[model samples]
Every structure is written in C-alpha cells, then in structure tokens.
Target: MRPQCDPSCFVADHLKKVPPSGIRRFFDIVCEADDVISLGVGEPDYITPWHIRESCIHSIEQGETSYTSNYGLLELREQISELFSKKYNVEYNPESEVLVTTGVSEALDIAIRAIVNPGDEVIVVQPSYVAYVPSIIFAGGVPVTVSTKMSNNFKITPEELKNVITENTKAVVLNYPNNPTGATMDKADLEAIADVVVDNDLMVISDEVYDCLTYEGEHTCFSSLEGMRNRTILLNGFSKSYAMTGFRIAYALGDSEIINSMMLIHQYTMLCAPIVAQLGAMEALRNGNDELDKMIREYDRRRNLIVDGLNRIGLECFEPKGAFYAFPSIQSTGMTSSEFAENLLDDQKVVTIPGDVFGEAGQGFLRCSYAASKDEIQEALERIETFVNKT
Candidate 1:
C-alpha cells in the first residue's frame, strides 16, 4: 500500500478557518425540488439584454476569442472611466485607475489580498455579501464584523464605524445598496462614514454592485465623498446592473497606486478577463442604459409588491430602498430564520434564504429576492402568505 498524506494538511491554514457560503444550501435544495418558487437567489431573471448578448455572439463570430490585456481592453477601461464621471461625478483614469476583473467577487478577493497583511483587521459592515468576511480571512486578515441594525434601516452608522477601529485595522468594506437587507446609504450617511474612514486613515473596499438597482434617493458613490477617493477601492460591475451575471466582467477603480498593486495580484492570478465578455461589457456600457432602466422599473414594481405583501402577512418588513431584496423579520413567526425557511421550502415549495446566512445580525429575518419575474414574485408572495397564515 502506498503511504498517503491527509488532504487537510496541504490546505491553507487561513481557508480552513473560513466557513462555506450559507446561501448555497438553499440553492442546492431548490435545484433538486420540483415546483419550487425560488426567491432565494439574488440573480436577476432578466436575460442579458439582447443587445449585450448579440455583441458577445458577434465577438465570437468575428473570432475575437483571445484574452484581453491583464488590465482589460483599453476601450472598456475608457468607457468605465467615462461611466463613473457621468453618473457619480468621480473621475478615474482609464489607463491607471481601472482594473477590470472576472467579477465583483474576484475584485473583492483581489482588493482584500492586495492590501491586507497578516494579522491586519478589516472592518466589515454586515449583513453584507457572504464573501466579505471569508475573503478577509483568506487574505491572512481578521474580519471585525460590525452589525448594521434594522432599527436604522440597516445603514452603517458613524458611531458603529468608530467603535470597530483599532491599531490593527487596515481597511473597511462597505456594500450599499447592501445585500440581504437591500438597504442603501445616501450622501449624508456616507459623509459621516467618510469622516470615520479618513480620521482612522484606513483603506475602504466599496462594493457597489447594486448601485444601479436603487429605488429610493440617490445612491452615493463612496469615492465621490470628500477625502474618500484616494483611499477607496470602488468595485462595480455589469452583472446586477445589466443583468449580465454570466459575463463575469467587473472593474475596480481607485488611486493609481492602489490599482497598480491590485493589478499585479490580478495579472498573476486571473491573467485576464475573457475578451468576448469585455466586448459585451463595453456594448452594455455604451448601449444598455435604456435596458437597465426598464429592468429597474420592473424591479421597483416587484419591490413594492413584495414589501407590502410581507408586511401584510405579519412579517415586520422595513422598506428596502435599494437592490431587489425584502428582508422581513421572522421573529413574530416564533422560529429561527433557518426553521422558517426550511418549513416553507418543505411545505409551500417556496424558497427564500434565511437572513442569518449574511451575518449574525441577520438572525430572525429572511432574504427574499424580487429579482425574479413579476409572476414569480407575486406567486411567491401568495405562497409565503399562505405559509405565514398556516403557521
């Protein structure tokens, strides 16, 4: 018999400490169940706008199947630069400040890895994207989780920010129009957090993946705030905004110095984002605004429908001003998020993720994405209503 070593012995120690994504369990269960009305996944049901898909097909027909430059195609970068300037009044140099990546997920990983040193504490606002905490850990950094309460509409307060800072702190991760809760921070809220960021002299990774899906007051780009652009690694993408989830193209914009360092890590790991995806992304940027607006309008309609429906059904749902999720408190249901979601899936064939999967503060809540079709959203609401009534 051949001598063998344990696989765990070869695995990176940091990764061994990180937990698997809590969101995926429901997704796998739904995939195996029949007649499931899934509001568990965060992806938009809309196909990549026809024009964007056609452009990708065109790129393939033209045999443009090569890898883009490690920094991504120059034209795509230039368009990204322009998009930021036009929408948020923030200027980034296409050549130096933008680093196109595989997705916002990849950009998040790269940002954490580039700046976080061993023993560094990265302050992470929760409940947020599942990747934030684990990514910090995987990069040899500790994640200091700060709970953004439902009482404040889940916005991260300046006081909360100040309390989490320490000498070991190196960066803060902000996601708004946030996940799970669908909360957004406006300029005033962001201005306050900016003060904390600047006073502490910490770097920030702002994930703005859902920036375009906002349904309330303006979505303030954190980098646009005073004294933030220099320290902010702004991450945005074509996935949620353009319904181009499969494209796997996103970009990070930041100080040239920081972007340069991220580029070094990116080039070695990813080599380059796919050329066809970049071309399609460029087309989406150039021509997809009208389509995006249409999608947002649909999401807005569903948002109102679901939020109202959940509240009517006895769940205490706060108004979600951005993104497409309705985080309804399940405390009144007399069950934990996991129990409520599991029973709903088993009895009603409706799938929604338990909110605690996002963070500890997410306990006693459930994240129901309205990014599904209007029919699906309406039906899911009805099923959820029935489940609530029976319980």
Candidate 2:
C-alpha cells in the first residue's frame, strides 16, 4: 500500500536548510581509498595516554557506570575548576559555574541555545571552525560572518570587531589556537577585542579546545580579562590536549546564572555526559600534565617539519603559531582549494582539507594537519611536491 502523504511533515524547517558539513565528505572518500596518507583529519593520531584510559577502566571495575547528577559528577566539575584556575588564571565555583558536556561541541550547542533568541545575531570570524554557523542557525539566530585575511595572519582585528557589532549581537564565537588556520590571539589581541566586546555589551563564547597545544606563546584566556569573566562562556575539553577525543567529555565555565540556564537546557537535551568518560577526564586533569607535555613537544616537532617541508616545495605557508595545522597557500598550483585537494588525493594518494571547506576566506589555501607520524608527514609532503611539480 502507498503511504499517505501529509502537507505537514515531521522534519523540522531548520533541518531542511542546514547543509551537511563539507569536512566530512573528503574524510569519507579518503577512508575508502587504498594507500592514502591523510593529513586531513584534525584529531591527534596518538592514542589516549595509558594512565587516562586506565582511569576509565578502573572506574568501570568499581561499578561507577551509573548516570551522574544532571550537571556532571561533582568530583569532575571540581577538578575542572582547579585545572582552569591553575592553568588559565580563571576562577569558577565548581558547583555553581561549571557544566560538564559531551565534548566542547555539546557545550557550544548548549551555550548557543541558552543565550540566543530567534532572530538574534551571532558574530563569527571567518576561516573558523565548521560548527559555529550551524549551531547559531539551529538556535534560530542569524550568523554574521566577518571575513579575516591571510595578510592579517587570520586574526580578527578590533576594527573588524567594531564594524560587526550591532544591537542584535548576542555573542561572538571565539576559536583560538584555532583549527584549520592554526592562529592564536596574543594578550594584546585579546585586550583589543575585549575592548570592543565590553563597549558593545556583547557576550563571548570562547572555544579554547586547543589552548594547551599552543606553540609560539602561552594561551591567554578571554575569561581572565577584567570584566570579561561575567560575559564569557569558556569551552574546553580533553580531546586535543590529552589525545582523548573519544572520551566524549568536555566542560563549560561561565557566570553562575548563565551556567544554571545552560544546565537546564543540557539536562533536557542530554541529561549528562558519560560517567566513565568523566572519570577519565578527571584523571586527565589531576595528573596528566607530564603526558600532555610530552605530546605537545612531539606536535611542535612535527609542526616545524611539515611547515618547512611545504615551504621547500615552493608552497607558501604561514608559519602556524599554534595548534597542529599548516594553512598553505595553494595558489601557485593554479587550482582552487577543492581542485588541489581532489587532485592531490587522486594523483598522489595524499589527503588534505580544502580551505574553502572552512569558509570563503579559505578559498586559495589548504589545511594540512601535523597530527600524524613523522614518517607519514614526510611522505605526504613528498607526495604533495610530486603532484605540484607535475601539475
């Protein structure tokens, strides 16, 4: 029998307009190909440090697998509070001002929902992460994009911030030690942007997932600035720093009122993050510094290797100051970013991300992650050179 069709369908209107993320398509294609060297993925190639993994197993053995309190385990929240205080010079009362989430990804979702009403404007700087735009749209807020240029090293200037602010601006999404671009804002840059933020009475959603992975300088927390703490929702996780991407644990810190509001949304949406993962994250916070230091040293080594190798191959790349990515200009190859990525994979069996996948500002470039093995990076660079020379 034919199914009866109704004019009123089940799918939400927002779902119809939201396009699938461009980053995933190349990832899927690369997984299906043989002998491909992938520098496309942003995740660390290393396994989660042994001790961190052991903590989760130990928790399970102790029969600690039940759902935690709706916000999260008190122990984990307290650990997060201590870590933030010690590392970033930010203070938060764990019980009232922190919410554990299923990765910085979910923390961002909850923040968007909590602060942005329908038709509100959420400002995002370009060449940023993929999730910000869709998250804003899903929350019924309009995304106002401010394009940043490579000439500026991809950092958003205060003048740029000033131009974007409007009465409807609810929040600005800040991704530092940024993905894809590998840009980090220094203290001066933060102060300049904070001036605009403060004057406009705008909120900041600071995504600092790559905070611990910085290379050139120490990461400066926006929340640590004077008067900014009350207006910033700081998002961080164990994914990049501790090589715990699969742990599915992250946290958000903000004013108590904002955190409480987010908790209400989080409880209804997800109930809680996995209890076992929270245990893993707790151990990561408590005693994972030595392992994290070792990992960061290795990433720094790879970062220099890949950047130098690409430059030697006649590809002009900005020396990344943070994160594990190299955003290299592929304009010399006479191909668009998409064409360069596709041709490199098809012809050389080397996979990288098209910069335009990030945004229009990324059109003439490609993002190569240095989170792979040293040998893998060397091989990928050679393949890229071969492809570039021949084409």
Candidate 3:
C-alpha cells in the first residue's frame, strides 16, 4: 500500500493563492457542446494575411531556424521602433530600448517581475484583464484595485486614482481599449491620469495591444505623454492587430535600464521569440496594412450589429468605442452575471463570459466578443434574445 501525497507541498505558495482563470471554466463547457455559438474568446475571426504567412515559410526554407540575439532580431526591432515613431511620436532605440517578447502576456509578466518588490502595491484598474491580478501576486506584490465606473465610460479618473496611492505603491497596470469592456481613453482622459502618475513618482505598465482596433477615435499611446516616456513600459504586439495570435511575437519599449532588466529574465526563461514568428511580424509591419484595414472595417460593422441587437432585446448595452466586445447589463433578467451566462449556455446553446470574472464590479453584466462572423453574431444575438425573453 502507498500513501497519497499532498499536491500543495509541490506548488509555490504565491501560485497556490491564485484561482484558475474564470474564463477557462466556460471554455471547457464550450468544448463539450455541439453547434454552439460563442462570444467568449478575444480572438480575431480573420486568418493571417498570406504575405505574412509566406514570410514565415520563406524564412524556414532559407534555413534561418537558430536563435537570434536575446533582444531579438534587429530588423524587427527597428521596424517596431519606426512604427511607434511614425504613429505615436514615441521613440525607442532598437538596440537597447526594445525587447521582443514571446507575447504581450510575457512582456507583461516580465515587466511586473522586473519592477515589483515584496509588499509593494501595484494598482490595477478594474474590471480589468484576468491576467493583471495574478501577475502581480506572482511577483510577491499586493494588488490594490480601483474600480472604474460605467457612468464614466469605464475610464479611470485622477480622483479615483488618487484614492489608491500609498507610500508603498510602486506601479499601475493599464489596459485601455480594455478587455471585457471595450472602453477606451481619449487624450484628455489619459492626460488627467498622467498627471497623477507623475505627481506620485510611480511607474506604469501600459498594454495597448488593441491599439489598432479603435473605431471612434485615435489611440493615444501613454508613453507619448509628457514626462511619461521614461517611466512607462509600453507593451504592444502583432496578436490583435495583425491576426497573428498563434505567432506569439510581441515587444516592450521603455527606458534602456528597465528593458535590460526584463531582458535578463527573458534570456533565462524565454530566450528569444521564435525566429519564424519574428520574420512573419517583420512582414506584417512592412506590408500587411491593407488586409488589417479591411478587418477593422468588418469589426466595426459587427460592433454596430451586436450592440444594436442587444439593446433591442432590452439588455441595455453601452456603445463600445474600441475593441470588439459588447458588455451589456443583465440586470433586467434578474440574474447574476454567472447565473445568466450559465443558464443561457444551458438553455439557448450560446456562450458568453460572465463579467464578474474580470472583477467584482463586473457583476450584473456579461462580455460578448463580436469577433465572430456576421452570421454567428446575428445567431448569438437571437439566441440571447430568446433566453432573455423566456426569463
């Protein structure tokens, strides 16, 4: 006879404190179902452009499959640097200030680990991405949340920001054109937040992965703000914009010292992003703009379709200005966010993410990604309406 061992002893204490992603439970349910319409995952419906895919194939055929510099291919870095300079007026040295990462997720993780010390507080604006809180916890830093309100279009104000600052506060994590809620910050909104960050002498980790998906207004790069260039780690990548999520290539731009610190962690853990993906990304930056524009136009169309349909069904959806999600209040159904999502999936064969998974403030709401085709969005909307009417 053998004695059973406790798995807890093998896991790290910080990891044990964290819960599994709220998004994963629904994913498992989805995988088991048949003929289901889903609005859960935040992925593009479009395929990678042929030119970009061809670039990767060409690179492999040429036998360029070995590792590059830990900092990544200089040509890709230079392209990234040039894009930032042309689009957002922010400049970074390709050699020192740019570090190509496995993904924006990796860049985010390494940035958190590079800066946070034990007992330090990192302010996370909520209803935020599911990864932010866990990443902070893993780095031995406390996550202090400041909830953004729907009344303010989910944009955090300087007043809300000031309430959370303390002597031990080290950084703030921001995701505008946010996930779960497609709220975006205008220049004035970000400028107000910038004032608070400067006054407090805090660092910022800005994830602008969805920058190219904005529909209503220009995407403001946070690092472009006055005095913010040096203190901000600007994270962006090809995942959302170029329909290259599978490639897992992204980059971080910041002061050389911070980039160097993140590089130290990257060289040991990730080494460098896949060279083939890097080659694909280089092609994306150079020649994929036309295909990207077409996809954006289609997403805007779907955004209008879903938001209108949700409101017509009495769900009370706010118009999302950027990204591809439609967050609608389920309060009229008299069900909690979780109850509504679960019951809808069970009753109508449609899938959505309960908003509370993003944060406590997300209760009474649901996140429906409009990244599916027009036909799928229409069918999901109809199914949701049927479920809502029956309730």
TM, every model: 0.98, 0.97, 0.98
The TM-score measured for candidate 2 stands at 0.97
Tens-digit lDDT string for candidate 2 (1-391): 9989986597889878778887888789877988999998889998999898888899889999899998899988898888878877889999999999998999999999999999999999989888999999999999999988878899999999889888899899999988889998999999999999988999999999999999887889999988899999999998999998888889999999999999999999899999999999988888899999999999999999999999999989888889999999999889999999998888999989999888888998999999999999999999998998898
Residue 73 local lDDT, model 2: 92
Candidate 3 runs further than 4 Å off: 1-4
lDDT (0 to 1) per candidate: 0.92, 0.91, 0.94
Predict model 2's lDDT versus the native. Answer: 0.91
Which residue pairs clash within candidate 2? none
Off by over 4 Å in 1: none
Number of backbone collisions per candidate, in order? Answer: 0, 0, 0
Tens digits of per-residue lDDT for model 1 on 262-358?
Answer: 9999999999999999999999988998999999899999999899989988999999999989999999989999999999999899999998898
Lowest summed lDDT across 10 adjacent residues in model 1 is found at 13-22
lDDT of 1: 0.92
